[model samples]
Target: MERFNKSRVILMPCRDYDEEEIYRQLQVGIRLLGGLEGLIEKREKILLKPNLVRKAEVDRAVITHPAVMGALARILREEGYENIICGDSCGIGTASRTMAGTGMERQMEKYGIPVTDFSHPVKVDYPQGHQAKQFVIAQDALDADAIINVCKMKTHALERVTGAVKNMYGCVCGLQKAKGHTLYPNAESFARMLIDLNQLLKPRLYLMDGIVAMEGNGPTSGDPVKMGVMLLSADPIALDAVFCRLVDLDPQMVPTNVHGMQYGLGTWKTEEIEVFTPDGEVSMEEAVSRWGNPGYRVDREKYGKNIWNALKALKIFQKKPYIVEEKCRRCGICVESCPVEGKAVTFKNGRENIPVYNYRKCIRCFCCQEMCPHKAIEVK
Candidate 1:
């Protein structure tokens, strides 16, 4: 019996002005890997899976940039690779809602790419296991001959950073995502589950949209920074390593990357890997210095201040909602989304208003944070 060889990763900087130029640069990177022709056979069905986490605008850095998808699809079409479809199963909601809320539907129409909802799913067993016995993946994702994983470069509250490796979680289909969270419970276990899922799916190609990246508390509500870079790879682990380095993050600290290497997914150490750029070649250190890490840095002063406030406002500020009033619509969705058995969050007025959260009973699962329709909730 023969062993499967590890995949290769290609890195490129996107200093281009617009979408077409960025796409062309990505094409250059892919060409280094024997081009898309080798990856996509003639008349084979291809699935372009992007990181559409929830129904949020594209510019918010919550999902993959439509421009990147359009560019990749255009390049595929030119190469005679038809039967392309765009799809994703979100974190806690339906793909349809994510598509509509994120304006991905409009992008799909513009590119003439069919948007698929991976709703009806099938179970796939993994013989060599790290955590899970089987996963319920969307049938279309499993059946496709080729899958192009398009992921947004963003920070995650749990996994640290969600990139090429983490995007494969979308393949789980629907609410199975939330269920996976419940099953794994902790970040370390959840990351192990992700590695197992990636091994099972084995996407043909992976692309990271780093032109604009999310920093701080993300994968959703983070500040968008201009990274002006994009990455392509067949090896998800290698790509994640490069992403980590680009952001000045220790790859070992990232749960997904650490577990991925342990599971024989790909290499995490920068010393063993080689990177090829679109123009003049540069080291991972230089790229990170130029681009800057998008992960959050804790403010010691702010932490001290919050502690003082918690002590001072013992009643109201004990566990008060640190709402981003700018982002808050006061829709009271968080109040309703709270799963407290005793109705911890109750309306202040007769009409819909931001409900006060009971600090003692708050599970801190961020279910309220995850389900907030208005993106209002935050933990201090």
Candidate 2:
């Protein structure tokens, strides 16, 4: 297989979402990657795919920072890339609402870029895929000539950490994302499908907003923690591997990084990847010593396919989502997001009651937890 020269990843020190500072760092990162002239064309329709998981205030760290997206848009427009648009298929609501709720809509409007509707689904066939042969992605994403992934750095209930690679799942289109959780159901299988999706879309660049990241319960509904850095790479796996090192987690323990290497998507090996900063290239040890957060809260456990993952008696061995009655708004977003055919989570007792889950039918997909707006659902 022909492998990409995805060895170099740049980490820029950025403590906050200052647009000018972000623009300067982004320019430096792009220059370090041999510049945008060679990577994307001005005539191509570019899609800015951000990790807009759902609507939340910027300070909440629930979605990619609007400042980062704004800075990138400015860079692209200044470089003569006028054919640009931005969007993401969120967990529960329409893409427009998520973007608007996150303040991304206003930011894009400043740059005269329109938001793309991700409600339209288009199927693409990939017979050579290792795990999935077909994907029904957002029409805008499929139609884009090139994509620039702007992802958030955060922990995820099912995937451990949701970074560059996992962010692409947003392209799966509205309810299909919920359905995908039911289909793959496990970390490894879901990751393989993500890898296949990346292979199919082939995003041109990846930029991660790590200055402010979510820890503990995340991808949504987590506390904001500062990592004080921004990351850039053409390789999603390598970018995510660097994320792992900074958080003091083992890259091999992440299913996407492991399968990403096995399937020739990108390399996570410390020896194979080179990390850079404004000063120069640094050893992984030095990089970790300078920036690594040993105290960072994230799931570092290795997930494997076993009978215990399915059996109700062995539920302790598995992470199951439960409703926290105090925080639940009883809006039923959790029940609505549950993809199980018969509805694994439902307001069986009454509409006035908090939604309940049938453990026997639950797939442990964390859909309910992920879509819960009030931080009412927790996995344990």
Candidate No. with top TM-score? 2
The list of candidate 2 runs beyond 4 A from truth reads 1-6, 303-316
| Residues 1-380 of candidate 2: C-alpha lDDT, one tens digit per residue | 12235478899888788889999999998888878988898899999999888888889898999999999999999899989989898886776787775668888999999887697898888898988888889999998999999999999998899999999998898878888888798888999999999999999899999999999988798889999899998888989999999999999989999999899888898888888887788888998998889888999865555665555346657788988988888998888888999999999999888888898888888988887889988888
Q: What is the C-alpha RMSD of each candidate to the true structure, in Å?
A: 5.4, 2.1
The residue-by-residue lDDT of candidate 1 on 150-171, one tens digit each, is 9988877566678988898888
Clashes of each: 1, 0
- The candidate that achieves the highest lDDT relative to the unseen native structure: 2
Lowest lDDT sum, 10 consecutive residues, model 2, at: 304-313
Evaluated at residue 76, the lDDT of candidate 2 is 94
Residue pairs clashing, model 1: 247-293
